[model samples]
Target: MVEFYIGTVDEMLQSTLISAFPIALLIWMMTKQRALPSHIALPITALLVGLIQLFYFHSDGRLLGANIISGVLSVLTPISIVAGAILLNRVLAISGAEAVIGRWLDSISNNKVAQLMIIGWAFAFMLEGASGFGTPAAIAAPMLVGLGFQPIKVAIFALIMNSVPVSFGAVGTPIWFGFEALALSPSDLLEVANQTALINAVAALLIPILALKFVVSGSLIRQNLVFILLSILSCTLPYYALANWNYEFPSLLGGAVGLMMNIFLAKANIGLHTTQNTLNKQTKVPSREVFFALLPLGLLIVILIVTRISPLGIKGLLTSTNAWLGIDIGGSHLGVSQSLVVSLENILSTSVSWSYKTLYVPALIPFVLVVLISIPLLNLSKTQVKEAFFETGQRIQLPLVSLAAALVMVNLMMLGAEQSPIFLIANAFATLTGDSWSLFAALLGALGSFFSGSATVSNLTFGGIQQTIAAQVGLPVNLVLALQSVGAAMGNMVCINNIIAVSAILGIHHKEGFILKKTILPLLVYGGVAALMAIVLS
Candidate 1:
């Protein structure tokens, strides 16, 4: 049991993360040494973090509930959003919607560089906006596969591209939920989250293009310097600007703008030749044929946008209900309260708030959108529509299971950290890093997310610490916290659970290390860039 001079209950509660660190480190080391299987290592790591906290710390039910709520919410919020995107994507795939999109995109430009820009950069960002969970990888992976890239290479490229819109992903669920749980003032939290999201958006534009060009032809990158720099500048600038103006739509809107421009710009190419010919002339789905294939997807986007708009969209037409149920402890309710402390059995027992926004307008609209318009759109039959649903369901099985399991593991770890000595470790680090803390703040933020696998959790764990350190040292508080947010998101690339969930969906089993290996350098590079940004901003 670790004790500190900080007497406030909240401060005491936060100390647990500091206390839990060494134990977590030990577990991670042991897990690595044994090369424990994911299923085993995840649960074991989760349990150890929980047990260490519960026995060592004394907390009110409300404190405990806060942690629990976040876990439960993770399952529903971002995870559900992910499931919806997957289902929608799967539906589109079975109905040939992606092919439609591919053909439409191809018709706009036949050049390979243009195609890469569209698919890898623009298209990937759009998917990131609509459904970010494992979707960028899911959608882009197969698209690259269809483009003649090997399965593993496709997966890697998709994964690399996925990083761009992650901070604001899934309708801003991570930041949105993180603020609510931490009990921060909405405006301040939104500002920090949005700024950080923008920072990543800028990086998003540059990294993928550079990575792609480098991956394809390292020397060829020099030839397209002007176009590449412009592309990077276009996305990075607007993403940052608009993010501060409007948080929810930065990635969605910015990606859309950049992607549209990328299509046209890629038309007048320099001279970068891909080692592997991307276009499959033998299996290329024709342009006209591709349009019909894409009808359902176009309808999906339209329906999603329209329904949320004027008086007749999906929300106006659908009924709303509170589907969430869980134990109410202390001053907080179940799901919401559990988020404040450590998320324990939050996954299984935390409340589910049944809000009607997009998931429930009835699959009928999309179905009709697909079946009716798609007849002329894709030249498909009733049989194909039915097959799409079946295929979508089949593909969803592993991902959904992996999602649920991953959520449980995350919940358990949150609970453990809340009750253990790990939080004290966090406090000590914060203390040592005071004043010149932006870099360290970012590092701590990254660590919180690495352990918890959520940027919101990273903020919750370290937000107050950053603020306190700034106040004490007379440093710029907002800048440090902003850096914290950036680091937290960067941490997602290497977060074990997210990596595992994504890898499982792509059928790259028993290769968590490989995925982590791919992500580490990128994460470090991004983190270093963010630290530089923090210094400049500070």
Candidate 2:
């Protein structure tokens, strides 16, 4: 067993700052030097972290080795989902789905604003329901690009919108797994969901304004305020209601239902597309072509719904059983046993057991199924299939390597938090806030997502701390936890892995800093509102 070296707040603070050096270096190099994270920044940071653990912290090679191994293994599920998304995009691209989708958009709306609300806000909400592990942007950003929007804008918009629906991501994983893991009762769980829904509802309504002003004219936004207001309500109302009734279906049903309502309105040319413009000029296209174009998305949605809601326990069938291959390090092994945890004293409190679940993950079935069926249904030839696969393999090479390195840094920090910078940062925040921790509740939540690249992991890190702080400060535990959940959900907008993946998928290539700069605006707005709401609600 590794000895726990308990340090004073001052010593821990110094250690934490030193530990943060790697991250600071990464940011400087990414933004200032324009270096590729995968090739240069990330690898260097990982090495520096390893040295920090070994020399400064005196952590044994075994613990450091386990941390690296666990960190690499942790992203397998997301990496699998991303690979599927990339494959789906590549297949769709070669199959001429974009042309059919473009015609479909023409048939629906000529207005860029209208298209964004549908694709950026509503459509993404549905995908978020289906798979919350950063897969929504991978799927939705390309769709918006097909509609003639800038890839960067689409990436930013989707990333921001993705934050609001994340509490219910992958079928309420953030709440069901993140919060419930804290041992809250049913009543407490419901309360947390309720407050969380409220926070997201506010963000949902505001994101459209940003999407409009940025994508369209400000004058257009002012003219379409009523329509925009109604559109937001159309989504958020159903989302909040379903979150209370069944957290699993808010994004699923809310997104699907909201899309229908908005589609009906857009078809009538209600807002910016009130007159058929060049962007949405009517084109002669067959209904069958439209359906064929949408078949892949159709398959994805149907598979998600059936697996998610079926009483036959399809979700369970897919969710159970880990494909764990253990990592051996100094008599301690780490692996992907979803429910199993490996804890090392004064190191990671609980390291998740993980393995490549190519067969069981929810994303695998739809993406794989879509690709296989598309070969016949979309009339894809053998040449096209090989090309798509080859292209995807090449495109994903940099992102996978970069993502793995970044995740390693995060895991090292999170698992060894007592001796990491996060500990110092959290303490500093607590000291600064005192009785006012509620004010920064959401910001802290966002910070977790930013570091861990997951709202669920954010909750895992902060839920207990939030609950304890709430107790000491005389606030409702559920309310504070709700703020944490909502804040972390918003943090998804700026998660490092998310930015990198979005850039890579959209072919932006090493513009993580630029993406971060664009996204931080909405991150601020969302966090600001959550902070204010926390003050009142908590």
Candidate 3:
């Protein structure tokens, strides 16, 4: 195995620039006036990265093949999650449930700003915590569009609102699994959570304000300023407090509490001064109709909560791989289990592997289960069910390709060499920034998610690097990790895979670049605020 030597200044600079070219090309092609469609641009980018890995990085054909295979396999999780969300949207749209949901929201308050805060901000926050694989945008964007918001604006806002909750998203996977390789003590991990929550809490204030700008006029936002402040505090205060109490459940419970509080405030018209109640003249919806309309989503939330809370033991059962059958072929091992554990080990005779807990992934257990259960409960005709499935299949086609390409690019960059391109870039940043690396620490985290499409993956990829840099630079390690986590969460706004998924779910194709243009500002602001907060803590 040949390592690209970065032991000298010229070598480091050369390595960093060479490694960064693919990412630069990707962004340029997407955001240019003649914007390339994600499905097109992403594959081109992936091929470029693969070529660099093979040539510049001196990677073997076997390693390259393994990484490509791993990338394809890894893509299944996001694609399935997106597919399930699309299916649910189809079910809701076909069954008239979406209309009922829109009206239910209107009944609470017809103020568009209030509705946006409740659903896009608070509701999306809770969903991100419970099921965060781009699921929040998948669920919330369509709901907002059904309420008469533009699909493009809704898509942008959904992605932006998904940020603050992401570090603790999927029941804190970003912390627990993201830092698992660090081997931190429970106490240190808790401190990371606490600092992450504090940083997010500060960034949370600006994020809602920014997301609101996409959906509502500045005048309308000003009219509802007090209510908006309450809305922001409702989530962030509890979110911060919960981080102190435990590493998990800050986003989940904070969003839950915020949803309830915001609903009450909106209903009472507290702090809502001038916006007219547009639904006031409409007849009231029956309780049963609302219940049935909300049933599938309600069930999904319940299932996610039940399975995630460790005391319940359901998470253990679903994730357990204790019983399995093992086999070896082509110098690789495979494990198949009755409990739905599937593992592939030593791919192509390299120390690379993958595993899928069939029951544990949110795509299968919650999203897919909710869809299946909704069929009988929603009482859809066979034709309607077919239509839903057909539409879901159609919508997922481009996103599947784009996601696969994006993940392949990510894998090639991260796993193609003993010192991958990602590390080279991080090292370059640290070397260039030196004493001021604090300002750029979060940017490194954002860079990770920009390519990899996940906060958990971002933290896992860069956490050790951030810790090492912190030690070398005389900064606190936990604070730096927290900044990394927060920056990764913010990166969700501009993540190519997320942009692709949200655009797909909204049935708005070829506007990924436009969405990225709109979201990049928020990402910058979020990283800036988080950096300042980290510096303060330091």
Better of 2 and 3 by lDDT: 3
RMSD of 1: 6.5
Better of 1 and 2 by TM-score: 2
Rank candidates by lDDT, best first. Answer: 3, 2, 1
On residues 382-488, what C-alpha lDDT tens digit does candidate 3 reach at each position? 99999999999999999999999998899899964437888888777787787688888999999888989999999999998888888877888898998899888
Cα RMSD (angstroms) for every candidate in the order listed: 6.5, 4.2, 2.3
TM-scores for the candidates? 0.73, 0.91, 0.97
Query: Please, what's the RMSD in Å of model 2?
Result: 4.2
* Candidate order (TM-score): 3, 2, 1
**After best superposition, candidate 1 residue 250: deviation in angstroms?**
2.3
Candidate 3: where is the Cα deviation over 4 Å?
1-5, 278-281, 416-418
lDDT of 3: 0.88
Q: Could you tell me how far off, in angstroms, the CA of residue 457 lies in candidate 3 after the best superposition?
A: 1.1
Clashing pairs in 3: none
Going through the candidates in order, what is the number of backbone clashes in each? 49, 5, 0
